[model samples]
Target chain A: MSKQFDNVSVVAKANVYFDGAVTSRTVLFADGSKKTLGIMMPGEYEFGTDSKEIMEIQSGELRVLLPGETEWKEIVGEGEFTVPANSKFKLEVRKVTDYICSYLP
Target chain B: MSKQFDNVSVVAKANVYFDGAVTSRTVLFADGSKKTLGIMMPGEYEFGTDSKEIMEIQSGELRVLLPGETEWKEIVGEGEFTVPANSKFKLEVRKVTDYICSYLP
Candidate 1:
């Protein structure tokens, strides 16, 4: 929602996955909360979550198959979705997607 | 280099270049300095710098050709290079590269 996050710590190293098709920078907050700002290249990806995740898509087009959902949800530009903990979801990303994923315990 | 940068601001959006093959998150410091923590997927890329740039390679295999250079310099794992302002450089990346680029005024 905000343009930038202030007074935080960012890890220099990125969390690279899918052979660099997906990459994120870890940002730590003062409240001990952790978030990842990431980029996902256009591809199909399935991800499992350890904690509840709130994914805010900043730009791009994509279809998501959330856990326990039979139908795929489409987001053309900006959107948000929540995934349950210990759940798996599928994404058919059609464009370069920029997202912020917030982890909740 | 430090493992992390503390007490900083991070832009939520990513700067995507070369059709998302190169993407970076902008990190802002208190002293008006700027840096970009970025990843480059295996490919060839040419970039021009507006200000002097100090590129620290955290990990990767790549060859760089700075402006006015005839030979391509190789970096196997970790290395550092500087490009003068308004200069162009070429990169032949063999592996996914994680780098921190500091922009100096």
Candidate 2:
């Protein structure tokens, strides 16, 4: 379920992964929900998640390799995808990509 | 000169500084104007710019010490400040900060 949230208070921590290829800042809501908004540079990166995540692309393009998929799919310009909990996904960033990841509890 | 541009094409290069305390993705325009949009973690950071920059804060708060200034001033939520070219400024991030830095030519 994709829904828009407003007035999110950001968490003052940054998560840097893959040698700084991707950097994310956490946003905290008053309802205890969490989201991470970040930008990914042009590179191939693999990410693991502890909870189910809905990744919404804000800008640029991403060639993503979802779990159990053999071919990578390109997502661009406000496209979004879901990744299940305890799984991983690989992304080949063709350009500078901006994304928002919402954690579903 | 604070202005907004639309449909910015993002460059694929990421400039990581301060051991990944700050990360920025380059956004290149068609006319060669560039901007970097990124997030700064909660820490004290010093940044030097080659050209004049107008830093627009999107969220959170920042305490900044401009060049030649002895005291740090607090800027919060949608506020902005300008830094002269070839100068440096120090920022104490009291929270996670998202900013868009526009380069003036």
Candidate 3:
């Protein structure tokens, strides 16, 4: 993938969650799709998604429990996971994580 | 200020600092100017600058001690500060702060 998103609009403010432990900036594409580039500090967080979210982890270590999954999935360095819409997932972020979340339409 | 930056390029990777206590996304303008949108968690941090920087705090509270200054400048809600090139500054972040930092040419 390209290292940079070109010709896009970026919101000035951040979407903060878990008392700033998880923060993201929204990037708006010309095709009306949006993605969030986010950082996750070492912490445990549960998130509910309104849309189908494909999370691409760029770096760091973490374990994820997707909705209705029986086992926890671990990713070190770089990986990805998908979550269904209107579902919740759990994350055990073992290190500082950089991720890009694309909300699929 | 405009709530969003249009027709800009955003690097996919984030700039992580202080073990994830500070993180930022770089936005590249068409005119070669660049800015960083960042989040600062509650903590104390000392930073040194290579070029002149204009820091606009969009939210949260913090106190800053600029280089060659004795007084601590406090900003609650929203405010801004400037740091000269090759100078060092300290910040006491009392709350989670969202900031947009511009590098002056």
Candidate with best TM-score: 3
lDDT for each residue of candidate 3 in A1-105, tens digit (9 for 90 to 100): 559999999999999999999999999999999999999999999999999999999999999999999999999999999999999999999999999999998
Instruction: Give the per-residue lDDT of model 1 (tens digit) for A19-88.
Output: 9999999999999999999999999999999999999999988999999999999998899999999999
In order, what DockQ does each candidate have?
0.78, 0.07, 0.79
Candidate 2: where is the Cα deviation over 4 Å?
A1-5, B1-105
Report the error of model 1 at residue A105, Å.
1.9
Q: Which pairs clash (backbone N, Cα, C closer than 3 Å) in model 3?
A: none
- Model 2 pairs whose backbones collide: none
Sorted by TM-score (best first), the order is 3, 1, 2
Deviation from native of the Cα of residue B96 in model 3, angstroms: 0.6
What number of backbone clashes does candidate 2 have, counting pairs of residues 3 or more apart or in separate chains?
A: 0
Report the C-alpha lDDT of model 3 over B1-105, residue by residue, as the tens digit. Answer: 559999999999999999999999999999999999999999999999988999999999999999999999999999999999999999999999999999998
Report the lDDT of model 1 for residue A59: 94
TM-score, model 2 to reference? 0.53
Model 1 misplaced stretches (Cα beyond 4 Å): none
lDDT ranking of the models: 3, 1, 2
Stronger candidate by DockQ (1 vs 3): 3
